[model samples]
Target: MILGLHHAQITIPKGAEEQGKEFYCKILGLLEIEKPDSLKGRGGFWLEVGDRQVHVGTEDDFDRLKTKAHIAYQVDNISYWRKVLEQNNIKILDGVPIPNFERFEFRDPFGNRVEMIQEI
Candidate 1:
């Protein structure tokens, strides 16, 4: 009896809300869901990803870390994402082969690792 993911929480530097919006919303094309009034004072916001979400939080002592521990999103078009990322100056790394999917990795605005995969 297992359930699916609720959401994934990531951290960004405090006071970078606009940049976060630019990356997650404008760049990634995720719809921005407004934070509740009770939570709005804390900074950060949410993005709609299917039924789940990606919750970004503000970290006071945030250090930009690049690591393999990341959240992977299933995509419709790798080529489209590739072009989009390139146009936005985001670096894309060809991810290791994993069965029948095309995979890649990139860093978000705050340097957190993110993975994208499209089924072959």
Candidate 2:
């Protein structure tokens, strides 16, 4: 039986590497790890988020649109993340709160939905 999550991924259109890095690394502060040589030809990125991995892969003909699917990264200080998004010009959606976690959503540069969450 399955035990736990290994990694998660989102897609961006081709040629958005720099922009992906800017959003995932520069703003979100995730560490960029080198891709394996076997996957070097595939354009994308890998980020270290705590013990989890966030993969940003490229699609040849992807469209920029919002979707119901999203990746939520559990973080400390929801207020701090809000300011970071706002200061960087990323709009934060007023997300519905759950019993144990507070959350908000936003779109990445390529328009894939992402959510930031904090546990109370």
Candidate 3:
């Protein structure tokens, strides 16, 4: 009885929640959804993407760049995203090609690997 993904989580350094919001919300434009009251004190936030969610949690002393673990966002315009990242001084890394898709990767301000992909 398997179902589709409910959410994917990524972490930021503890107390860096405001910076996380700046990147994931102000820059990337993901909508901030209210976290459950019970989880509110845990020091993280939730985001809405289409029908799914991305849970941005908080941790400390973790090196995020050392992992390939990431979230690939489905976008409408890969080129536009590239320019946007570049304009913000975020370095873009070329992604391995997949049939019928164009994509790229970058590290968020907190060093989380993030991918942007679009159907070709």
**Superposition error at 28 for model 2 (Å):** 0.4
The list of candidate 2 runs beyond 4 A from truth reads none
Ten-residue region with minimum lDDT total, candidate 3: 1-10
Sorting all predicted structures by TM-score, with the top scorer first, yields: 3, 2, 1
| Candidate with the greatest lDDT versus the true structure | 3
TM-score for candidate 3, please give it.
0.98
- The superposed Cα distance between candidate 1 and the true structure at residue 74, in angstroms, equals 0.9
Per-candidate TM-score against the hidden true structure: 0.92, 0.93, 0.98
lDDT of 3 by residue, 2-117 (tens): 68999999999999999999998998999999999999999999999999999999999999999999999999998999998899999999999899999999999988999999
lDDT per residue (tens digit) for residues 1-120 in model 1: 768788899888889889999988998899989778999888899989998989989886655664556888899898899899999999999988999999899998788889889999
| Residue pairs whose backbone atoms clash in candidate 1 | none
The lDDT for every candidate, in the order shown, is 0.88, 0.87, 0.95
Lowest-sum lDDT 10-residue window in model 1: 60-69
**Candidate 1 C-alpha error for residue 49, in Å:** 0.6
Is 1 or 3 the stronger prediction by lDDT? Answer: 3
